[model samples]
Target: MENYSKAVNLLTDADVIIVLAGNKMAKLEGLDLLGKGQFEQDFPKFAQKYDVHSIGDAFDQQISSWSEKWLFWSQLIEQYTNHYQPSEAMMNLLKIIGKKKYFVATSIFGHFFEQAGFNENRIFSVFGDWTLMRCSSGINHGTKDDRQVVQAFLAASKKGQNLADLVPQCSVCGQPMELNLPLNDHFYPDTDANTRFRWFLTGNEEENLVFLELGVDETSPQLFEPVIRLVQQFEPWHLIAADYPQADFPLDIQSKSAGLDADTATLIEQLDKNRDF
Candidate 1:
């Protein structure tokens, strides 16, 4: 109760809030990449052929052809993105951050934040979003929205038609296009959004900023250490981690940080209940 009060106070008094969300947050939002939840039932072909039972394992397998790969990818994307519904925790988070100056830096590539009504400009998807596609010609030919392409493939697939020609090609180099994910060596980060996130940090250096760590774990080391260092550097900055314990943080920022040692849903629900406005 005391910890919840402190978290509420920090959020209420904060001039800006920075959310760092990761894989566990993705799981809470109904996108469990590593779990074996109906993967074989939904995607029997891929499961039998590749001997894979999870999305993460499926991604690691090299499919036989580009068309087959796109077909599989389309099914996954359509199910996750086109059919996605924001979870209760996401709604509570929105209420907790009501009208506050905020930004989201997430490693989840499913575009959950954007779909949940968060400002697109304020989000920096650290690992890139899967809904966009880039040239696979080992060159940065820019990204294009592949949602339409995904829809086309799904439509074709439903009719049992060949998905060979439906595979999207890069307009710039006429090369094959791939999902904007760091699957291999050719993945390019979103530099424009990265610049915006950096500027937001610079602008809020002196403000009473709160770093809300939501389900960040070992998978995304990039989001963890650097944020802690930033909190240590900025005297007015505070950290509220949903998963980490207070004792785990450095002694310097211990006074300003609150590690709730709970799941993201619980923390967000508490914040929503405790928030005065």
Candidate 2:
């Protein structure tokens, strides 16, 4: 209860909120890449052929053909993202942030923040979003919306049509296109969004900002040390980590930070309940 009060107070008094989300938040939003929940049952083909039991394993495997790869990719994307609904915790998070100046830096690439109505400019998807595709030729061919291609594949699949010809190609390089994910060395991060996120950080260096760590775990090493260092540098800055314990934080920022040691949903729910807005 004391921890919840501290978290709520930090949020309420904050002039700006910076949300850092990771794999566990992805799991809450129905895209658990590491877990084996229904992976074999739903994707029996990949399961039987590659012995891949989870989305992570499936992505790590090199499918025999581009046609097979895109078909499987489309199915996974459509299954996880096509009908995505913001979970209760997401909604509660919005209420907690209620008109506050905020920016989101997330490694979850499911387009959840955009779908949940966050300003697109304020979000930096650090891992890149799967809904977009880029050239596979190891060149910076730029990204394009692949929702249409996904839909086309799904439609054709319903009619039992082959999806070989439907595989999207790069218009500039005439090479096959792959998801805008960090699947290989060719994956590119969103530079424009990255710049914006950096600008937001520099712009609010002195403000009473709250860095809300939601489900950030070891999988996203990018979000961990840098954030802690930032908090240590900025005296006015406070950290409210949902998954980390208070003892885990450095001694320097311990007075100004709260490590709730709870799941994202529980922390957000508590904040929502305790907040005045």
Give the clash total for candidate 2.
0
- lDDT for each candidate structure: 0.92, 0.91
> Which regions of candidate 1 are displaced past 4 Å?
none
User: What TM-score does candidate 1 get on C-alpha atoms?
Assistant: 0.98
Q: What would the per-residue lDDT of candidate 2 be over residues 36-105, giving only the tens digit for each residue?
A: 8589889987798899999999999989988888888899889888889999999888877888899999
Error of 2 at 201 (Å): 1.0
lDDT of 1 at 93: 92
User: What tens digits encode model 1's per-residue C-alpha lDDT throughout 8-74?
Assistant: 9989899899999999999988788898857888888789999999999998999988898898999
Off by over 4 Å in 2: none
